[model samples]
Target chain A: MTGRDRSGGTRAWGLTVAVLAALAAMWPLLPDYNQITLARVMVFAIFAIGYNILFGYTGLLSLGHALFFAAGLYAAGLGARDGGLTAVPAFLAGILAGAGLAAGVGALALRTAGVAFMIVTLMFAQAGYLALLYFNEWTRGDEGFNLPAASRTVLGLELAGADMRYGTALALFALATLIATWLARSPLGRVMVAVRENEARAAMLGYDTGRVKLAAVTISGAFSGAAGAAYGLIDGYAGATFASVQYSILPLLWVLVGGAGTVLGPLVGAVFMFYLIDLTSGLTDAYMLVAGAVLVLVTLFAPRGIMGEVRRRVARWLP
Target chain B: MDFGPHLMLAAIEGAVAAAVLALTALGLSLVFGVMRVVNVAHGEFFMLGAVLAWAVAHLVPGPAWAGYLAALVLAPLLVGLLAAAADWVVLKRVQYDPERTIVATIGLLYILQQATLMAYGPEARPVAAPFDARIALPWPEWGPEGLVLTWPWGLGTTAWKLVVIAAAALLVALVFVLVQRSRAGLVMRATQFDRETAQAFGIPVARVFALTFALGAALAAIGGVLVVPIQQAHYLMGGDPLLLSFIVVIIGGLGSLRGTVVAAILIGMSDGIVSVFFSPTLAKILATLLVAFVLIFRPQGLYGTRAA
Candidate 1:
């Protein structure tokens, strides 16, 4: 409880090491099909981690993060498809595009707080989706565009093969987790938490709350974009579905289920949700209903999420 | 200059859109105004109403008019009751926190939409209009010789469309009166103004919130029932209405009834006219951009007063 006793940095680093080691060990053991699923889980885990930067730490619940994710996906995909770019350059373009878009949108969206902020983001994301849908010639509309394998080579590593793609996803997931963990303990991250806890007090304490939030949003957007680019490359396809409102909600769902504000919570949340849907998808057409029920149950009974509850129970043993 | 007939048709279409949007947006605004909780699942209630109308009209073994009339009255009531029960079970449990309620209602949205998909199937089903009549619209045309009045061949609107406009307008008016004049209206206003004081004054604030939520949902359901005759009932139909209603509520100022109606008309009219002139996608894109601008410049909304 004391400042010296708060070993958050050590705990975060330890968890990161354990998780990466486990993932690296599991990568070879997983069958090809399960590898693909694990790759997707890692992709979504990156997304949920990026989202938590805004929602979990800053307490800004944006209902439109899919816009950034989609922007990144399209930028990276199109770079390969049209710009004749290699994988690294294309993915960087995606990150920059998503970050730039989020910066611009965050400036406008952050003007309003709470519900207004949520609605504004939703509207912008919807517009992005509609634009993507309407501009069918370039985006292939809803038909979905394929990512050519020739352009998927990053640093001489072809991402087309399942093993290569899984390895890339795992690497990216590890890097994203490390970055997120580092940021959460940074001084800027402290200011963000202060803003989240009480914006007025933070402002009175000489913190430019707006700037902090903008920075958070921009950083979060960049990470989400990177995840999206990875997702597009991993799947070797890109489409309008990436920009949907439903996709936007998915990260939030994962974060809430895993535990908001915690570094590793999103990973746990993403894995649980991906498996839950994957397992139930074959059994019934109402997996959405199951997901919805789980959401409500989590909101009501387990607001702290799976990891949050676990942390609470094993507080002394874990940290 | 010579776009008169097309303009008239567009205006008629706008009126129809405005009519339905007004009812749907009014409910959304009322819930926000009274409870300060945004109901993301409000559109599902509208979808429910439409689906229920289809079910009732089909299940009732009677004349088409009789069944249609029964559905028109019963569907909204049933949806309202369903929404009220949800509020009791889920919303109340969350204690109506704005953020949590948004997530809760989102869950409700998926639950309702998927339930309907499971029960009603994925097909879009139409309800027969209570009556079959098309009134031709006449417009003045300028010819080489002179100006003349002529009835456009396919510019006629159905009798039911006009009826829907009239009925929706009447319902909106009735809601205004109920909110502005009745004793229940006073209690609602008091509760909206200050909840603790209203509770202290024996206004039964909790019941009022539940009633307001139910009433808002019922209003949306009524809009759905009315529009089903034209658009058909489907599982996935709630998305647009929900989006449009949010646009209307936000631009009108959250919880302001008058603002909501005015914004609905402006948006609906522009949507109709723009769709006719350009493209439906363009209309939606423009409306969404307008919401972004509104949030930046006037976060309090067009008519919403600053919060104390």
Candidate 2:
């Protein structure tokens, strides 16, 4: 919005580049298990970042992003397995499916605001989950399916290798991060925030608030869709569990914990959440007990989440 | 085997489901109406009731009827108290802010689920019905001269299922009496109407909120207790009921008790009939989409006047 914001953006760009460099450098040193976990973290990070566009910026709390994510997963998984598309084409198909679904969902769902929107989206996702189960011959139901080992090769880089897998995930994460930060600073992004702050006011200014919301959701789907596509391809699995309400709640949780409306919050939140679960599960089978307790405490004391808090107290230009 | 008898069986089974759903959805309506907060963990409370009933039944070394009856009586009460405590410890601290409450309750859901997993294990465990007797149902058939009654194959229901229907109706009746006639009901209604004004009148709105939350949970628990004999108690059992009750609550209209029950019956009956007509998953998908369309086209719900 100002010159200061631009310079803040530059500094942020430098910081991101340095961070990426460090991550790239550390890739070879990390163990095989850690590399896989890190890839998962980046995938969730992409999911959260994409989710933030609508939830954090547009102020639309969708409990159905899992539908888009799973749409992407299935689109890619099936395309490569059955449609005989290459890895890139399969991934593109996933993103297109995700965006198309989000646009369709937003068309009807956006008519209702607030809680109605949430419930409508939830029901749609519920339908999607059931659809996945109903078409079990194709989806393999709850058990999910794996792509052929050859299908795992993306752009001639075999994701079967640990380094290639982690590098590809990191590359996707960097792309998502760049796009997210750009969107946050873009004119449409400001309009989205305007809508979030006050939809009536935004509409009064002659902005098509509905379109902006739909756009936000569609773009969000594209982002998370890429994550889902990458995740299925890299992880070699696509399953119904990823389409469940639990998956929907996970992105929301990550966004809230990382700081809503912040470009980098999703990454921080996803990493923190990943490590938190990883560490807790090592000690006990009831890792979710600890996770639940942390959620309560975070909501109680740090409602702004990690990055939201960071933005407030330390980094005024975090976004 | 025939369409008429199959439809009849679906209707009866649907009634059984409607009975349970009404109990669950009514509870949801109360909490949403009075407290104005969505408790995402409501189904977990239901799961707890069934799990607790199983535990209680296991502890009681007696006839199956004796243990089952004890669980039916005790589980809901215990769950209500637990829900009230949760409200005090978690919800009250958050001031019942709608979004925050959702997150907190989700957190509460995880805690409850993980605790159950730790203590109860991941297995689906079932408790026996207090009494079970199969009785054949007669279908009317047109003869050459007159009408005759014929027993249809697979048209029998257990005595316990009828008991569930009766028990649910009685509990629902008790809730109506409590809400419409009792002093606490008046307080709850007052709070629901206007929280600040009720507080000004020294209504102890906070306590009413707690009571409303507890009662909602208890109703869901009763549903769970009744259902446990029919289905096993699993940690993951809460998810479907949660989705179905949400559909009922929305289709019924938020905070509209009559509408909630009506929608519950409508949904439950359709669920049964549709499952019989098609696949169960297809039935669920249709019901879910129905709620979404209902909310989109008529946010007021079937019986609701206001777009709540």
Candidate 3:
């Protein structure tokens, strides 16, 4: 790599190091509550990254992302609740459930483009949410469900404490980041970018644009499911709220505000949004108002997002 | 249940729902037709109109009829001005990119919803009808044991529903006349068809767009005001309508007023009839599924022309 590439790669590596360092430093100082918050933020970042694959890479806006997220949460929650599976198997089940759900929805929704795609995805997501609500006996509806506290074991190693959960979350976050980075450099990743740039042209070049979109959505859903399972395990609860329209949009905002094109963007955006939510909740009861204002301001002034802005400024300084 | 009364009620409910949905969807369709941006915040404009109508009625403290009249005339005009200003400030800047505009409008939706919550405190505000009077239609009743017939009447019943329906119809008629016969409407149609060509022909394309946005806002506001009598105005009232309007616009076809009207009516009737047999939540799910199926098969919608 050249100096520029080296610096870019270094910056990416530095982010992981910084996050790990911060986690290590804060481990002893953070209470259970803050640990839970950090875990939630990391999980949401995972979810947002999944979203960025489809929205950022493929240029398809699927409003029903919560469907996949919820599928994972419910799969894990139900599987673990019934005592049929442990943490690892339940987590895998969740990922499978999310992927299946995305594949099914993507089959029909990927047929159209633009607003139609948005509406179809939204329709399926809402349908899934309603189905959960209607089957209240199964999902417990809006009341939500709690997971029994069990010692999480990873390959014969016992992880029972809050610290262990934190470590587990960090490991999952790292794995997700690594996978996302690898995918971005893969041939499939290049095809996704090409599809995003021009679907017609991509199709003209003998690419199955529909299959590419579906594959991206399916993979994205799998990661989102992983995130949801982590969320359920860490929080010890899962609800239909995880599948709501609000949850669906929050990630979109995170991706947009942090910058969608970069792997680091969703991570930074998630952390920024989570902290912003915490800060704004302290300021006013209307956290949504502040969020909305931020969305508007970002879209209007910084369409390239925070990371994009930083890159531009850094480039100007270097030149 | 008597078939006559059941059918009558369903018809009335369907027609009223259709009228309101059509008026709202028309504005949305028109905006999308001319400027390919789907205004996600259109529903908020509708909610604002409803809230304004309630505010005017409550603050003025007049005869119920007078309050209704005031809301009908003033609420839309005021909200239309607000819509025009929003178009000027935010939408005009991002007109070239539909996707960016979608994001921007979604942002605007958040701001408007938050502003509403800040103002109204997240509570549902009920708007009282001007008159307590009800019109009852006597029905033939059939039972297992005996035959009984009675006129049905209640608070927020059929008469008020009809009144709202009439107002919506009037607005639709007005829009039709304006678009079909008026000079401004002709200019708008010309600009929508070919922006560059219209500009080349010395037509004020920018002005047409601004005016179209304002008009769409005004129509949405009217729908909002009409809906307040039946449903309470709240901060989140805009969300359901926004989703429903999307379905209507998609089914009707983008940029076709006639298509929007038909789609809205179809959706409204379907919702009403489905809700009667099934739960409201289920009805919503069904309606959404129906739209999804239709879009998958006929991607351009029932009336939409294929994009070039």
Candidate 1 DockQ category?
medium
Model 1 residue A45 distance off true place after TM-score fit, in angstroms: 0.8
lDDT of each: 0.88, 0.87, 0.81
> Per-residue lDDT tens digits of candidate 1, residues B155-204?
33445777889899999999999999999999999999999999998998
Q: In candidate 2 chain A, where is summed lDDT lowest over 10 consecutive residues?
A: A11-20
Q: Total clashes, candidate 1?
A: 0
lDDT of 3 by residue, B1-308 (tens): 76655655666778888899989988998888887778989999989988888888887766876887798889989988887788888888876477777777888898888888778777888887766545332222222222223233422376678777887888888888998899988898888888899999999887788788888988998899888888888878888788888889888877788888888989988788777667778988887887787788886787888530
Ranking by lDDT: 1, 2, 3
What is the lDDT, from 0 to 100, of the residue A67 in candidate 1? 96
DockQ for each candidate? 0.62, 0.68, 0.60
lDDT of 2: 0.87
From the highest DockQ down, the ranking of the candidates is 2, 1, 3
RMSD of 2: 2.8
Residue B254 lDDT, candidate 2, scale 0-100: 82
lDDT of 2 at B109: 90
